[model samples]
Target: IPDDLLEAARIDGASEFRIFGSIVLPALKPIIVTLAVFTLLGTWNDFMWPLIVLTDKDLYTLPVALAALSREHVQDDELMMAGSVVTIVPVLLVFLSLQRYYLQGLLAGSVKG
Candidate 1:
């Protein structure tokens, strides 16, 4: 993201598109990854909005469906635990898969590049 680098690219006859693709996007990688992780976590755990917007039972998200399940099976601890596991597993897997990139993004602005 140095102005000098962009100037050099322009002086070297690189098109604006090429400079952006090669320089701007690479510089934005950490921020983009961090944002994606945060977005995924937010949407994955979101409950109230989906509950209000999605009226159909079949269109329910995991958290809303799980809430409905809990309402129906209040006395069923084992089933509730299983449902919780099912709901959490995919989120866990996604975080694990992107953990390194996510952490890098979080730390990107912490130290001077």
Candidate 2:
């Protein structure tokens, strides 16, 4: 997003790919990581679309599997809780691992030019 850095790279005869790899990509790292984490979380937790699209039992995602489990075990509170925990833990770990970048992206977006 910094025009001066890009202009300088152009003046130095860097290729577009080089400029992107050396300058733009590094500058965008935090935001990119943050976006990746969000995208992963969204995809991981998505249930309805996958349920609607996937008819095969083996292709069911974790959420869909959990939903099926819940339907079959409606009276079992402990099993449902365990399933819920299993579904949530991975997303929690991923968010915690990339929390720094997520916070950085939030701060970066909040700053006014």
TM-score for each model: 0.69, 0.67
lDDT of 1 at 100: 78
Report clash pairs, candidate 2: none
3-105 per-residue lDDT for model 2 (tens digits) = 7767878999999999989877766889788789879989998989999999998999999998898898889999889988998999999878877875654
* Model 1 clashing residue pairs (backbone): none
Model 1, residue 31: distance off in Å is: 1.6
Compute the lDDT for candidate 1: 0.83
Q: Which stretches of candidate 1 lie over 4 Å from their true place?
A: 4-13, 103-113
Per-model lDDT: 0.83, 0.83
RMSD of each: 3.7, 4.0
In the range 28-97, model 1's lDDT, one tens digit per residue, is 7877867887898899889999999998999999899999999999999999999899988998888788
